[model samples]
Target: MKKTYDVIIIGSGGAGMIAAITARKQGKKVLLLEKLPTLGAKLKATGGGKCNLTNTLSSEDFMKSFGKNGRFMSTAINMLNKDDLREFFLSIGVQTDTKDGFRIFPVTHNSSTIIKALEAELNRLEVEILCDTKVERLLFDGESITGVQTQNEKFNSSNVIVATGGLGFPMLGANGDGYEFAKELGHKVTDLYPAMLPIYVKETWVANCTADTIAKAIIRVDLKKAKKLKAVGDLIFTSKGLRGPVILDFSREITPLLEQYEQVPLLINMVKGKNEDEVLQHIKKQTALNPDANVVEIVSTLLPTSVSKELCLIVGAILDKKFKDQSGQVRNDLVKIIVNTPFTVTESIGFKKAMITRGGVTLKEIDPNTMQSKLIKGLYFCGEVMDLDGPCGGYNLQWSFSSGNLAGHLL
Candidate 1:
């Protein structure tokens, strides 16, 4: 739309929108380019369309959850932190509330509300937005970014923010163009994986219990000897494999290991509160009280009937056998299976089902203080394009807004 602008941001996702708003707030001419006709397509689908805006964790705790690369986000996060994010939304006329004491969402409970609010803010700020505009390449002059080029023409700008997101949700227009741009510019892109997707297990029996959820299931992944990765929460059964808060959270760790092992082993603690011995004794006590009851019926009280039946099959226990008729070895085997149900993870459902991308442009190339490129001046990166992914809830959105604002502030 313009021959030159103060800031031209690629991709109209959360980071690009925030960057546009922040740059405009500084009285800079901003033009936002979107690949899709509609803006914020992925943002609209986040948190099942409610748009989890930010989390309620303390700043220190919040950064810790993101792992080592999170330290790079310290300055950006501190500059426009969670409180600032919530306040920004409130200032934009979107009142926010938190569910589960952490995940913050618009009180309206509709993601369109957020998109509307952002659009209104951009309109009020006079930031230009061009939809259905695909940026084919970056127009650079060796060390500094000059602008971006589409098929028909080149839009010139000294400052260009590449917020094209990651390889997650490709159908929503995230085609990894941002990573390609970074690679073309001599920046290193890390190995990418599905960050927050359900894992597919080799056991087909788990698929049959699609209606059942393993509440309070403790999921553990085998690491090197004498070490293991562990997470505790509910695991919801899916037609393909496993899904839920715990499985989604555990997926971050599970994906990297999946790369090396043919089958990543995951052990589930089906009965949460009891140890192997405690659960065995509990079963013995139950059998003593009702010796005539079927083993399936007794175990069903501990787990879902479908799951219990499957577990019995796995442990060589006959569901029709009375509890009193079951041998000690059968009892021990059943207890072991209940305490530690093993599943071999074949792979994740992949980017289509993944809520976020695990890796992107390496952290060292971008200055966290400003989100500007260390190698290429006037070029900035933010959001899922960076080598940063957080746990489920609202951390990723917060990172997007914070990093975008930081870049815009410094721009």
Candidate 2:
């Protein structure tokens, strides 16, 4: 005889595990399926294994970070915000710390600690788990979920929650299975893009500045339509191009635009938001104090020695000449470059290098309140499978837990 579960949760990532736990707690028989031999493969690699679980942002501010589509998370976040997530972890015998007073992580500072706790909780609740099981397709009638078909066997359940996540980090078991399931069931899957990854730029000069980390750098898209798209954080120059916190966050916005344009032009404020006038004023002040300082020396006061030299070279400024000896046009151009350096983003590192994916199942097809499919009964979606994605810190993980919690209710 085939046994029937009250609910079947696909993929054992953070969302799937939390959904299984939540359903089992409701006294419903639950089944968690994972494609890999081990569960939480991607979760185990979050924050480079440090596991940023959640952040301290309030609900309103937190939602705003995700941009316009953020409102889709209202119900889920309300159900289990950062505070609730912390309490839930505490109850599960895992202590979390916000070392920076914002982003939360297990006190042990290991992603294994989080994965082990989640695994233990699922075990304690007696939720059936099946690793090395890849769901081939969802089994459903015309209007409702009947079960799921896996590679080796068929699972029986009226309710199914798809938490298969997005197609980022394929080596970590991300294969876009959830999007396929949603599409197979007549749901719309938006165009997908690789996000939160490093980018390659056209200018080879960035290679010369690889050794320096520019603090408080602001990167903005030079496109007229995307004039408001910008990010602020520490920036790093990679051998190929740009990376670090600023580029990672800004990549999400740029990836979509990349599909439309061959190369995206960028204006990088390397001097910590200093305008041309401000940079010129600083240079004039420095020149007044030391009348004999060369152009590189005067510019180095505002930026690293290497970056200053590069900017000076870009403007054709005589590196060994005093600031007053340089042509007025050369001086102005150097100041402009110092304030707003330009670069062209040629390409991204792609999904294999991306930390998360942009775009998933469109939000309108699923109800945020329950994470259940609006077009199909007994079907739910959670985690990166949905359209919502946020910047670094703890936004994405918290959304996974919250949406999973909402979907687990089986309401």
lDDT winner: 2
Which residue runs does candidate 2 get wrong by more than 4 Å?
A: none
- For candidate 1, lDDT tens digit of each residue in 1-411? 748988899988899999999999898989999989988999999998999888899889999989876788899888888899989999999999986787899998899999999999999999999999999999899999999998677899989999999888889998999999999999999999888889888889977799988788998875574146788888898877889989988898888888887678888897885789888788878888887889998888799999989988887887799766778788888888888888888989888978899999999888877889999999999899999999888889999999888888754
Query: Candidate 2 — worst ten consecutive residues by lDDT sum?
Result: 331-340
Where does model 1 exceed 4 Å of error?
223-227, 288-292
Estimate, for each residue in 379-402, the C-alpha lDDT of model 2 and write its tens digit: 999999989899988889999999
The residue pairs found clashing in candidate 2 are none
Q: Which one wins on TM-score?
A: 2
TM-score of each: 0.95, 0.98
Clash number for candidate 2: 0
- Candidate 2 differs from the real structure by a C-alpha RMSD in angstroms, to one decimal, of 1.1
lDDT of each: 0.88, 0.92
